[model samples]
Target: MNALRTLISLVFAALLIAVGAFPTGAAAQIGAKSEVHTEQVQARLLAWAPQGVATGAAASGAPGTVWVGLQITHQPGWHTYWKNSGDSGLPTELQWTLPPGVMAGDIAWPLPKKIPIANLANYGYEGTVLLPVPLIVTPEYKPGPLTEAMDIGLKASWLVCRQECIPQEGEFALRLPLRSSTALDGGAFEAALKSQPAELTGAQQVQVAGERLQVRISGLPEAVRGQALELFPETPNILLTAATRGDAPGPRSWTQRWDGAVWTADVPLSPDRADSPADLPLVLVTDDGQGWRADATVSGAWPAPAPVAAMSPALEAALAANAARGAAGGGPAVAPPAAPAAVPAGTFTWALLGALLGGMLLNLMPCVFPVLAIKVLGFARHGDDRRAHRISGLAYSAGVVLSFVALGALMLALRAAGEQLGWGFQLQSPLVVALLGTLFAVLGLNLAGVFEFGQFLPSGVATLQARHPVVDAGLSGVLAVAVASPCTAPFMGASLGLAVGLPAAQALALFAALGLGMALPYLAASWLPAVARALPKPGAWMDVFKKFMAFPMFGTAVWLLWVLGQQSGIDGAGALLALWVALALLLWALGLAGRTRWLIASVALAFGAFLAQAIGPAVLRGAEPAALQAQAAPAAGERWQPWSPERVQALLGQGQPVFVDFTAAWCVTCQYNKKTTLANGEVLAAMDAARVQTLRADWTRRDPVISAELQRLGRSGVPVYVLLAPGQAPKVFSEVLSAADVKDALAALKS
Candidate 1:
């Protein structure tokens, strides 16, 4: 199945290139437009003429100006920053490579809206927006031919943000018609021009008094006289943009008042202010979205710049590299830092503590208990040997902590490179799921006494374990995390979410804390005198107990197989089970003596290999991702439909409440809720009474959309239940949910 998915992806990529469906930087000859589609944004270079201007003109005749704009359309819930991105974010940048005779003007940025993220506020645009630029053709330019086109090349980069920030870039080349003015997308261009903030023609004043930065405007448009207004500063880091409390929409962090003809606003100045410009440029917008720009004269001395937290060198380097990647061959210009959500003070410490507690609680979860049980049994065998027990425990803790840090680092690096991944990301890969299932199945067989290490191992090799008992304990810790981390036990989700937004050093510390928490209990059992004394003495019944433990191992294997079915469909799961059977048979045969054993093992190995190579591709070809199928054909009698941002918005627009279940097949906690509280009869009745829409965002497979939504809600993993009511903030449930939780949310919806 893994091979099949990889092959399909490769084939599609090749097909896109062969058919010219892939974006290219080559000059577009057919139309005066060059477009590129990044993962979350669709950007294009458009050429158009002013209204009433004739498109027909001699190629070598007159010098005229045409309008060219970089038009960007963001996916729902995503946005790109404006020139002055308040709080944090990088503005869109364009690097032009034009003909000697042609020149381009600065981007005519349209008025931006305040985008609040947690406590921080950013200035940006959502939906579709065009940044128009003027292209001037001077008399110094000589036309080569009557039919020749003006070649324009552009290299552009932008930082797009939803819950997280992604740095993206594209190269575009447009061949504008020299013989005639190109007026493509003229309506869009006209609308964009209208959206631009009109320059103020009235007197404006700016004065600083203590902590307040006051602005006064003498003349105001009658249309916006008594309405509430939003102020957008053109200068960065001059005013405080972080909200005082939550993300509830309201006026700015300061206050504003209207004195009939004159408008007055008093906003707090940022303590982190490092610049004091003579003229403070600002844009004021009314409730009706009309805007005017003003450059008010400075009237007072600026305060001292506050001491700020120093950014880690690694973070600084990464930002530098990201900026370099976009500006590679385009000159010395660099992009502004990609400002993700800032980590508030004490966030790291809180998250670390949460991660540790969550890790300790993980031992009680069904997915992890079996592994920990085996460790406990081993502790009993060690009995009174405190030194050996302590050594083994330390080794195991080291393994667990190191493994967690490694995984966290990888996740962070991948996210930095623009992969929308979260916790339990490994389980998203079919290959990893298959491998873990096989490992658990083999362990089950071994525990059940179907095969013994002594039968197959050379004498000296088998004794290696006795000489290095800690090696076995350490490996067990690695195995436990592989199967258990996907559970996302209580208190873990928020910590993991916070970790992603933190600096690398702090994030890794949180992961290590979680591992330490998970290992603390076992370490205490091994080292503490009273706890060690309480352990059961080894007896002849130990063999029987070991075999009994095999059942739990088998159960885990079965669960993994079921998860595989959810990802690769039934055919993939069936193939995997067949392979497991063959593996068991081969292991048994290897334990036997003589040529009969060799013959059986040889045949088993060959058969298993053949099944993997031949049947795997066929299974892949016949089956689609189970998540897609489940959405198309929901389970019998289920009221839930597949989730999408568009659907949620549409439902909310119609005055309906929404309940979204962010889940995945591998997430055991999510399944528990699904079969329990979410399915409770009383809960369903309440939901029906309230007409609450239920949408399931299945993360059985790698889904960027669901990932983004989870990030937006400040969660890094699944089992997230969000109840969104119109005109209210979304209410996110705890990791463990209950019938009462759903009922109460429904009750609130009704209220």
Candidate 2:
């Protein structure tokens, strides 16, 4: 009987151990319920109600309303989300269980800080936050004694994230003695309430079109104008966060500016949302960390979408970082504000006129002189036929205008696609320069009577027919533009710069006007019978003149080859010369007869292919030559340094005056300035005395940075001179530089 009783006791002990080890679902549930009130469940996040009183009464002064606070403390590096969690994350949620006749209001969130995780940006809070909630007490509540109290229970759920995320929930209860009057001190909760964005008091207007939203506010203090400020949208799904415009406008971007008493902002709406709400909430924060909240109403009809220009990659990256910083409630690097439409009223007209004048001046440039001579000879051939001359003139004008338009369109298209190109950008390519050089060489040989192209063609193809005078004139116009591109004459810079920034249609019109101006002289000469009669009759002298013209063509070819060498190095230039030789040999073989000619042509073609294969990679690779480096390096006693965006910014930051020369070796105007004005000892002496930084931006080869800078300055080509005085907007000088110009700019800096 004793052994049985001991065995039964052992069995009872084993059963008790099993019950403790594997509890029932209901028991586990009860334990979890009890653990909700404990602070140790998730140490990373803690939720509690701050000790406070019903702050007298609500704005309505009703007995039913009382303001309270729910405080949350997060561990280091851990954070909870705001109403709108940018990029990713969920917002904190709270559910309240109250007695009869009691209600809870929405959480009044304070301004959130931007939390960046790798490349992703989020809006949340770190450290401690107090969320204010208005509790409504009904009039039916009876006045209670000290032991009688009101029970307020809150169930809080939040996601705490630091590199990883953990979901946490807690139940909190607060017991407060019933009272008619309550005293609440202005502590953390009061400070948080003060930090909340205030409702906008002034008139506000919002405009929305497509994905863009713009807001204008009036009655702002004049002092706020030009101050660094950031905008935050409280409306979820409308905007994740407002991007500070800083100085430069960005695509799908936000920018704000205060115009004296009124402030205007341009905000890009989310692409995923449709139909903007009539009412919007916004928070405006100054650089000093002060914030104001306001609700704005949409007013005005949606405007049509404006054409958006592509921003440079560098600017885009900078703006993105700026936006992130702004979201994080940090001061962002501001760019100089976009100068109020540099092209004002009547500016377009002036630009068109300038383009015309510049185009007319282009005729006097050395590059265009060769083409002009050919046109003159062609004119002599038709001096007697007034009708034919008139028709040819019209055809030539059409060709010139159409070519300019085409070139402008191509440039605009490329710019839209983010190509940092400018005037004569085609010449930046070694292949283009080579092809142009070869064409000039062939044309020179043709003019020198080396071989007639007509003889090589099958038949019915007139190589140089005077009967088709219109065609001849049109071809002449094409040639004129080809050579004219390398030279940027007076008035061209400003006009082209303006054109580059204008609408495509307007830009094309400006280009056409320039072409018309260039063609005007020839057009007038052709149309006017008296001018046509003044020309000397066609004679053997014409042949002599044509041969004379071949020398200039050859000269142009040599210049192009030199330019190519500067771009592709000496070895690449040598390869080009060999290719030219092979091409000449092929032409010679074509002029010969029978199997021997075919064999020679075959051999020439093979040699040309080999040369091309050898040179193609070198040209395409675009390796900077040692010679370029030597040229870029400052010479002894020279004050000029190579231009770089960083160096410019550094000098400007140090309050040093800078004189930048945007130039290229191939640009005749650039070369002239370098030799005549920039190289003058007096100018150099003045620059040295004034301690002005001189920078030379060489555009001999395609540099996207330089190209983008030029675009920013409203220029499309070389020979741009800018004088940046300390703490002042850059003063642009005329493309044609002079000693007086340099001295005046320096004197202005002193003033």
Candidate 3:
């Protein structure tokens, strides 16, 4: 989350704070629904791809007739969607009021495709599309050259998207010679339009005329649609709508049977139902198998009359004028509210304190517990290995402390650039996890007496190589802190929040303070030479202790397996098991022939191969969204997604704060704040009611979308409880929530 936040903040600053100064070349960055385009052509009210067409259209050069189309050009390994821009994205559309001597026509859609968006899937274009249209010039048309300097001037609107979406608009001008109907633009555009399947030339009704509910899909299958197809309705006023938008269940074939001779399309969705009225254009979008997309029309489909209620008071006031001009009509209306003032200083102070306390308490978390056991056990077993125990404990303690400073410093650097970071984030990265896994696995094998590390020359075990009293103890302190910190929690929230937001000097002081808190016990324990001296001399007990260390290490192995599972799934876990077996066998071989470095090297090679397979895909992602999201998300510490019940229980067990937000697509309020307030650093920090674990649930689609998640959260609608708990029952906020609202809830939870 921090990495993306850093980039986003940078981009946001360039766009909002310093216009046209973005270093990455996007001089024109706008809000989600807003776009600032400097391109050659302005888009239309809606740009129909193959599967779906926009709401309104102008008739072509023919009288009492019209046509619209979706043009597509696919790129290798990439494709643009037709009607159903599968998985996630808006389909093309166009809405217009016909000019005085013109009659409108329906779209001539091209084709469509199916795309996968990680956990979800969608159908759309991966390349480019040039949707065409035919407008009808009525007899009222004033013929020819002199009367018109330009052909037609129409307002265009549409949403263009890649991984993200941006709305576009422009004026489409087409001049026509009333007397001579020579092909315009050499008919190149027309020829391309003709290349499209005629079935999609624009028809709305598809019923057997006899069968009651028989299905009939008019569009033909193209390569872009792949071996299957999914239906998407353009508007309201149609029967059998749901049935049309779904993929055919069998092998590589689509069947739209006539349902007892009736034309039908699904009903339209609305924020307010009363506003729904007959007359809007109903476009049904469908996909071809591979790439191109085309949507003719599903008969009996039309958009509901505009919802006057969704308009603001000002816009609603225009309802009268709009009615005079035949604008959208309907009921109750509301205005978008204003945002509140900037956050207060006091809120920041508490957040910082929470981060601090959380960091201080992290030394005791179960995640770090195994590492500590080994640290403690190492010295106890080797406490007498040296002549005296004076420097042993201090050396180990030093290693732990130093490693922590390095981590703290790196996190601080990222936060300075406006990142939202959390503790134990390193473990979340596959590279780091795999490396740690390798480190621990080797250490475990060494402890099992396969070979021992001396830290320096002939060195293997970090504990064995410390040369001097101070350096050895200091290095040990550094190692302990490094190994232990990534797994601990509780006070981490406050600590991380403070480190990220405060001035560098203050942040370092706070971090050092937290480190001091962690090192305190060991510092004290190290000072007592008598305690170390009291331990039994090295013998079979030493072997037992060494073996004991392996168990914690074995635990580390298991933890790595879990992390691997998170990355590559069960297959990755399987490979890890194979690596383990190979390791075990090699270790056995080493016991029989300790001096055979080549044999051991081969085992190391096998482990390296295992790591390559586990982390290969993630490494190649570069700046892909999934990788970026992972970088940005603070590891839930031990929990995964917010929707998981197992994670909720784990957080509850720790008595930590759990912040969960139920959000959705249909809600404007949710979108507004998520884009503005919720993702902000201030909001993230204010969330320190207790050690906070943040979770987001995205609600986009209607049924399968909300259904699957709702079953998990045990909720029906969104804008629900954004539960925040410090150490108690979660404090819940209502649907129309805010940043301050969350802050206040967090404050209450802390109390």
Candidate 4:
């Protein structure tokens, strides 16, 4: 993009240098560049009005006639949004600066496409397009002898984005003859252009209900699908996003929606052009998910009738039979359920604020409290040394912020790739659980005085701790917090949620915000003199307190192991337990073995791991997966299978109305939904009464199948609900839910 900007700059310089060539006239000494090139951009975008458009000047420059053309071309991968950029973005622009006596009409823009890019979606074109802008000549305007040369100039600007956005600018110029009218080629370029989306004759205040964007596409047949249907608004922010359901409308003739809508209609979706003008591109997405390319005029009802024989035999026969039947009996039956009025979509800001508040509350959580205490005590111990205290606090803060920033970036990257992840995703990994388990085991051993660091191999006290005891406390504080990484509050919850939807910078900012919130208490403790004075003195009893602190780490390790067992099956649990045992035995041997044999023993212990692995996973496979049946089932809804596209498809094949809930046990939002919405008696009754087969995709653990399915639906996180009504295509809901919404949907299906 920078290279293109440089080239654009150089071209402008050349154009300025060429200004001296213009002829001097009596009234006005006009100056203009004959021709110029736009920036040599790196394939991000290149849109232009083609000169190949048909020219139909009755007489060259006769009366108000003038030569005009369309020569537009766009780059690959790169695209520019239409008038309405949708959600958040601006459209392409071209400012005409023509010489005196020469004027150009509004440039005609062809249809545009709405392309999905990670969290945000954009509306633009992918390839070259021809936009025809007619040139108009005033009847009295006459070119003087010296100023016969005419110049056309344009200042173009567009927003380009791939992973990040770069604003591009350029100057396009065209030279023209001074004749009354001149002819220009308009065929080869004109044929390649796309047409605008079908629009209503004029602005219509349409009523939206549920997933239906009800506009009167009058004179159109009701039973349209695939490339035959779609909606585009002419109002700003009215249609923030596309709808989430339909093709199988409750009763209406047309309904459409995207995957982000929760529970069908209680939550209103923003129209497609949320942050910009509605007068923009609205490409039609066929029912089959194919693009609806333009074929003809943008002004009247689309698509001239095909030849008489173009109609399908089945459809034609049905129509004929319907006509005969209507003549013999009556009109076809009409069923229109009263659609609930449309509602407004709330901002991601609210969710952000919630996440922030949650981060603040998280400071009070038990898992975090003990760690904070240790951190505070360390500060108190170093209270007399204020500089060291500040450094420690700042180091801790840096570590926390760094951790959250990394996590936030990872979330965004995964989401962009279409993976549905959730909070505590690390906890879902058996390896992480095992590693944490091992860490805790080590911490416990340290507390048990099994061995000592910073001291002689078997000494009760560290060899260096006698000189640097404070160093140990600070290091311990860091590790304690590390061990508590999985325990995040609801505020961290929403920030992570928004992080997935924002640009990397904004996401990192939010992540850093949460980290600051988490570290604020520690900082306050350090600065508070009263808090510093309340700590116990450094003495023999310090050992006891340290040992007592080790117990929490041990317990935490045990909890991690259990979580691992559930995640990795029995074998993983066994392997982890075995690994801990091996470490303990080896350490004990080291403490007792003579120097001559110590090296040999250590080598054997280390090398033995490979031999154990060669013996197969069975040797270390824990006894956990087998034990799961004995444990009470997780509180998943009645009969909801784990999320699997194949399983959901099968359920649909069985003609059962399947409701697949995508959730993770570790996600706070998921837990809230379970406790309040899905677990509610009313929702349960409705589930049973409606005969809805429920399927749960437990994203609590990594499930490749669930992740792929989420990508298929254009989502990368949980709290996704898929409603596959009997004999209809599946529809997705959002991150939130309600019992009434489900009930209404169930009732609609029954009818």
Candidate 5:
């Protein structure tokens, strides 16, 4: 019951936050003319008459209609869509709230240009464009006192695009007084009206001819008889919007031929077509911006609809909520809210550099230290064998590179299959965590000389390792990556984040770069004769050195156990500890005499297998619901609170500064920060002084919400530090955090 309740809470919070988490790019005070600005565009609501207008004063008389235009000014190279967005975009939407009897007409869409990105063609407007909507004042509206004015509120949303897409919105309220009209903005409105497509009085027909859509029209303007005309379909999914080859403005999207008076075109229909209509609506625009609208009868049936692609759970829920909200407000459904994908911080070259540097730095992290120490011991063991050292180094480098590529490929594949995942996703599973802990324990025991595999194995099996010395080094590289990848180094966060959004070939290249970087040090040590000479010669003290290195492996195992405790609670940790004792017994039994060894090994193996079968599911599946919630909660008197999208948004809406720590227990870097800088009293005092709400987003478990939020910020792992102030862009901190970094960020938030 508690589990079900927790699920319900998560669902409700996700849906509720979807309404406002990514809403309204800008805010403004209500007025006769209101303007809101985003990074890429400016949106303004303007009345046709700037000064007040009295009823029945104009020649048309008696307060019939007034025009209000939503004007959008785009930055160079950016554009917003028309009523029907072609290929891969969403159309702008307007929802109005007005006084009784004042109804709003649909937007008077202007002529759209074919804006192309890569090979996809989009129907949208560039530069500056005004969408005019008429407000109809019915007889039911009565004139009030002289001071009375009409109040109109509008919520507008649009998707702007260049190389990437950004979804933005604005809320505006306008108050128009009852007085005389000045008509100051009349020219803008008139221009928009002139740009509107003229209704066609010509013969228009459409037929589905196999895989193509055949459209025919006649009675165009005489001047346009021999001129090439551009076709803009009003109804979506009727024809392919992407070109057959090359980018836009190159080859014509559709084949066009004019036979003197009549115009005819054969365009391939969309393979993923989702709509079929009896009437086909299209707009034909000429070179001079003059356009004609045609509503033509269809003569044949559309092809069978293609299977729809699945949506992410977050998107699916957001769409459902949008539909519900639209029904409640009695308006058309608006576009779903979206987190603006932050443009990658740098270019592909920079990303590759970051990945390379990040991988090199991973050698310094504690989680990876144990593996490096073992590799150092191996180098010491083979100090006199230069050829062997070089061969082992090559094998190790190959292992690291191939392992990183395989892991990167799997992550990409899962993401393509609609899983909201990120780097270090493997650590989210308790089973993987348990298995890694056991593997480390075995390594620690071997290093400590508890049992050697060769002592018990047949001569044939034991000699296999002696025959292939490089295999051991290769396996060590794989083990290093398995343990170290979770500790996201400085540049790795951004590089990994950007990688997930890039093309497969490029993304995998970045991953391979990271692996190559990690292997560089070992390769250099093996290849450089001077570096090898610098190493201490092997001696009796080497055994003690090896034994000392065993402690780090044991330490790593203990840390993994702590991480498991965080994920599955104390009981699960205890269960694993019991399994470890059985494992130790089996290892010890291998060193005993024949009969005793067999007898004890038999008992130990049976006991370990039984325990695993009985408690493995319970431990690996994680803690009970109550325990998980309790773990999520902050301890007594702690300033930090558990994070949710709604919580962060609610605090921000109240003008509160918020600091979010996107972290996980398995992340070694995250644990270090939590123990050091984040726990500092001075940092806490500064945050409290600024009244910043501290939120801890625990990603110890698989959390789709946190994963989605991370992707939005262009990060694939923790610890991600985000400082957000109301009405300001978010400030993201580096992965290697510090006390001074916190204080500086807080101080800036105050400033």
Candidate 6:
């Protein structure tokens, strides 16, 4: 009886330990048999299957391949990335622990969707997706029954994203009976295989030039050709996926076309990576969720795309029409060009030369004259010190080069961000114009001996620092660039246009060349002692010249005021004049104030504040109305209608020739052309005879439509002459127009 009791207690203890070791739920699951593993992760439902691994001949017969699949169902709005995740995101990863004698192939990626998030575009999949993997089973593998199944494990990790992203991972196991016969049907696997990109039916060709890739695909369906398509490169770091867009040929973008049966695309490549043109792997996807895989070969050398002269007339017309439509909608109209062909080594050399010539000519423009005069005076002062003169020259050149580079970078950055800004974009703002006007007025007053700041300074220090070569030279460079904004010289158009589309380093080099050109004359004069000596000696004559220089500053101020008046109406101009008066009074009071300087300064500040408060709103409000009024009225008997992109398109569509004068009131070059060439009686008569529909795009005010149109024409500033003949690409003329040039263009139109 005692022995029986002891055995019972031992059995009870053993049972208790066993129950503690395995909880009821775990124990039940361990005993449960299943062929597949499924789990719900953070943002996705995942399932893994060793679907085709079967017992008998299927496993023990001659070595064969088995298909395994991981099916992931994303939560609504959540997605997993493709092999190439554009802009940002990570692709899914799978690691397997297969039985010995089994080898796994790469995941067979299905077609992915282009997922746009905010301003960025990503390639990914939404909803349910199955990733298929093929496994090779060796003949050495043993067959198994349902009770003794083969174990296959998978470690899967992926990123799922909505507005935010979540990383998820799971370890999954599958138990499958080894079989002698193949499994003919796999539900999810079959579907996944169907979704795989089909191989292209015909030959594909790829051409690489500089940072661009062009692909020619033959034998595509018409429906697929007409629809918007996206290209996915299997090779990483070769192309910019985010830069992809619908095909429109230009200078620095991706464009695609379907020429009836064959499809062609010019794609922008990543500048940071070098890729061979041979055997490019690509997948082309349509908007309707169909995709075709194509392997392209490098058949021959791909020449860089030629300029507009080589473009087809029909294509040019179509691009122009698109611009017109965008203008009509009051949106950005300039379509980015096709990925620019690699510029030849000689091309940059020519561009640099053009930039140099243009910069040298820029010194002659009316707007730059005042600053140039100031610089001449500075040179005269530094004439006695050779070292100082050289130093000043170098400093001036540095300033000019740095400023150009900075401005070019800003323009490029803005363009990249989709802002339709161009050269002299700063002048388009009335506030900038007003500020510059004020500065010019103050400088003019100082030069004219009105309340000199030097008078208040101690005599010794004032005399000692009267002329700072470095400061004067640097400031002169700044002033030169500021005034030069309103002028675009000959050769400047092509050079600047090319620079804007080139790679960043090349573009910057072009800007540097321009600056070097502008500063060359001054630099040469300073460095050559003979040239410096050729300048007149410093004397009372310089004082007279200095005072005379004030006149140009006043003139510039007057011009800026006029531009301001055009931007803002008469009332706004009056407000600016009032502000100027306040400034003058403040300066006068400061000069006269002896003991009560603080009190006078306070009063002046209050008066300025009062004026700004009273007039600021009116000035801001008047700008739009002024622009509208200008648009409504054509200059009296001007024989030119106000220009709109819509009007240009209509006239072109009707087979009538049109001449566009892109002008601004502040642009001295424009004013000169208007007075000299455009106003010539013979030119007017010729146009009249040709029945040319004259259109004036007045850019005196901030006009987005005109701005976009200028950019579309590859110009950044005013005084652009565009002569459009019926059914032909428009001819862009020089900034400084001549009667003969206008006549010749018109005669060509007639012919």
Candidate number of the best lDDT = 5
List residue ranges in candidate 4 displaced over 4 A.
Answer: 1-353, 364-370, 455-482, 592-751
For model 4, the run of ten residues with the poorest summed lDDT: 625-634
lDDT of 2 by residue, 1-751 (tens): 0112122223422332222233334322122211121121232211222332232222224455556555667767778788876555567787877676667889888888766554245677887787777777655444334434566667787666654344456555555545433334336656777778656687677887556777787655566667766676666556534343555545545677776767787776654353447788777777765677777888656444334422334334444554555456554222332222345558788888999988898889888787777767767876688887788778878777777788788877776664666887778877667766777776776677765565465444443344455566676677678767878889988887777767777888889988988888878887788886778998889889888888998898888888777675555466567666776677677667788878987997677665555444443335332110111223234466767665677788788888998865334455457668888988888888788988877654444456668768876666789988655768887777778988987877667
Give the per-residue Cα lDDT of candidate 1 at 620: 26
RMSD of 2: 34.1
lDDT of 6 by residue, 436-542 (tens): 77777777766776766555546654544344546556656766787687678999889888887788888888888888888888888778888778789899988
Poorest lDDT segment (10 consecutive residues) of candidate 6: 1-10
Cα TM-score per model? 0.43, 0.42, 0.43, 0.38, 0.42, 0.41
> Global lDDT of each model?
0.72, 0.65, 0.45, 0.50, 0.73, 0.67
Worst 10 residues of 2 by lDDT: 29-38
Estimate, for each residue in 270-300, the C-alpha lDDT of model 3 and write its tens digit. Answer: 2222322232332333332222223432334
- When sorted by lDDT, best at the front, the candidate numbers are 5, 1, 6, 2, 4, 3
Q: lDDT of model 1 at residue 350?
A: 79
Order by TM-score, highest first: 1, 3, 5, 2, 6, 4
lDDT of 6: 0.67
Off by over 4 Å in 5: 1-346, 623-707, 714-751
lDDT of 5 at 558: 96
Cα distance off (Å), candidate 4, residue 541: 1.7
| Model 1 alpha-carbon miss at residue 623, Å | 9.5
- Pairs of residues clashing in candidate 1: none
Q: What is the C-alpha lDDT profile of model 4 across 354-393, one tens digit per residue?
A: 5556656667776665466556556545647766666666
Model 2 misplaced stretches (Cα beyond 4 Å):
1-342, 463-468, 594-596, 623-707, 710-729, 732-751
